[model samples]
Target: MFINKAFNMKYLSIFSILVFTLFSSCNNPSKTVNPEEILIQRIDSLNKAGYDITDYHAHLKGGLTIEELLEHSRTSGIRYGVAVNCGVGFPVQNDSALSAYYRSMKDYPVYQGMQAEGREWSTLFSADSVALFDYVFTDAMTFFDKEGRRNRLWMKDEVFIDDPEDFMEYLVTQIETILSTEKIDIYVNSSFLPDTLQSKYNELWTNERMQRVVTALKNNNIAMEINSRYKIPSAKFIKLAKAAGVKFTLGTNNTDANLGYLEYGLEMIRECDLKPEDFWKCKK
Candidate 1:
């Protein structure tokens, strides 16, 4: 009888351990959750919290058709603004090409954006043709330096960086000019430095310099883009702009079909405490 009792107790202990293990496994949430699901949940939470969550700098390059963009938007839970490059060297340079491009995709649900390139874009496209877009945006990437050399920041050969300090000052002046003179709604690729000076972005973009650009944006009523592709205009710059009541737009500036999720912009929104009111929305 004593042996039988001891055996029964050992079996009971084993059964209890099995039951506890099964219960723990059933209640574990992390084991069943995925990263994509977590991202979607956070996006849904932000949407419910009054954020628009739009990517205003998508491009149709790399065979990225409207159908693919729509599918990506649906899966990611983000709205899109498809942009076309318009300038001297781009595909759509003149007013006729701009109008035809607009007519081709005007029926789509996504917002149409005009990415005005080069300093001569204001002269190339008429105001009436430009006004047809939902919004117009420009960057300081293509500008004539003080030496009268046309510097394209993206192209290594076209860029001329003699003195880093001088280059930063000239770039800041170019940005100020673009914001003040150009009739653009948003300034994409804000605070971009050439690859040479990219590492010194924080050191080069001083408080006074940042204030100068922020002041221009405020004075001209131009929204600054929180570019996810470049992850630019640092958190400090963003906070200063926000404090000065400058509006912002989220952009990807995608050159290919791989439209990355706007991780940097979303992080900035949380870090800088940006609300929906801080963002620029299209009236149309």
Candidate 2:
């Protein structure tokens, strides 16, 4: 009888262990929750709260067609502003080409954007032609340096960084000039540095410099773009600009078909406490 009782006790212990293992397996949190899904849920929650999460710098490069863009917008719950590159080197250089491009996209539901490229864009496109789009925007990327040499920040060959401090000062002045003189509604690629100076962005973009740019945006009534691709204009910059009553727009500035969700811009919205009223919306 004692032996039988001991055998039964061992069997009961094994059964209890099996039951506990099964329960733990069923309740495992890691198995049921995914990080990507959580991020999507958060984005959806923000959308439901009436925030118009739109990307104003989507390009048609890398074979990204309008139909594909529209489908991506529907699935991602993000509105889009399709932009065309307009300048001397780009395909849409003249007013006729610009008008043809606008006419081609007039029937689409997305906002048509004119990405005025290069410093000579003002001379290339007339005011009447510029007014044909929902909005016009430009960046300080293609500005002539103090040496009178044209510098495209993204191109390593074009960018000439002699002194970091001098470069920063020059860039800040160029941004001010663009804001003061250019007839643009938004300034895309705000606070971007060349690859050489990119790592020193925080050290270079001082409080005084940030304030100067913010003041320019406020004075000119131009909105600043929170670019997702470059993830520029740090939270500190955004907060300062917001305090100075500078409006902002979100942009992806995508070069390929894989247009990433505006992760950085959304994070800024939460961190900076940006409201829908602070965004630049198209009247059309």
Candidate 3:
């Protein structure tokens, strides 16, 4: 495990907490059982089978503190890669801020991740500073449309889809460009679509488009993120990626403190028949 020394000190405590919590739940008079029992069981099974269950896309926004995140890790049995958004308009715009952010999180028991925001992130921070984190990840959600308009896909108002077919081809091209040009470890929020094109996910993300993105990931040696928050990159996409020898990571991309138990990601693991070798681990 690529865990920090401080994390080792707290490992026993976290394990003890999980044991006691489970015991307490079973001791309830009604024995109704906790709803998370299934999730916890799945995590335990996966861990016992040699899988390092982890969440690679977590944030500190929405009043969530590091202590709270650590506590969640203990109970959920999932390690985390806590990231700070860095880009042109983000908080950590320059190397000075990036270094400061790393200092604050270096001692924590979690992997420090940089969520590179826009395409211009290449100019915002130096490669040396970006490499300070355990791993770096980005998405194709922010790109310039053919009209030269900046499109932040998540924001409905900022997304432009003049023609669905044309938009999808352009989106795939942008994704391929990012994978080939950027020095990133993971590609997150894979197969995401704007609000307008969301309903046509299956139609827009055709096999050809999926193959182009998957080929890029495999060629670049980048892991793909199975985003739980968005529940994207349908099972078909995952199976295809796996068939081509592309590894995967689980992510929440949480907006607040509600970091789910990686329900969707776990489902994909089973559906895609992914093995320990099919997952990516950041070696620090």
Q: Write the per-residue lDDT of candidate 3 for residues 1-284, one digit (tens) a residue.
A: 65776788699889999999999887863566575877988998998899999999999988999999999899889999999999988898999999999998999999999999999999989989998999999999999988999999999899998889999999999999999999999999998999888898998888999999999999999999999999988999999999999999999999987887999999988988999999999999
lDDT values, one for every candidate: 0.93, 0.91, 0.93
- Evaluated at residue 8, the lDDT of candidate 1 is 100
Lowest summed-lDDT stretch of 10 residues in model 2?
A: 34-43
Ranking under TM-score, best-scoring first? 1, 2, 3
> What TM-score, computed on C-alpha atoms, does each candidate reach?
0.93, 0.89, 0.89
Model 2 pairs in collision:
none
**Per-residue lDDT for 1-284 in model 1, tens only?**
99999999999999999999999888987888887777667777888889898999999999999999999889888899999999979999999999999999999989999999999999999999999999999999999988899999999999999899888888889899899999999999999888888988899999999999999999999999999999987999999999999999999999889887788898899899999999998887
Model 2 score (lDDT): 0.91
- 1-284: candidate 2 lDDT, tens digit per residue: 99999999999999999999999998886888776566566668878988788889999889999999999888777889999999979989999999999999989989999999998899988889889899999999998887899999999999998999999999999999999999999999999999988899999999999999999999999999999999989999999999998999999999999777888998999999998888888877
User: C-alpha displacement of 145 in model 3, angstroms?
Assistant: 1.1
Count backbone overlaps in model 2.
0
Which residue runs of candidate 2 sit more than 4 Å off their true CA positions? 1-36
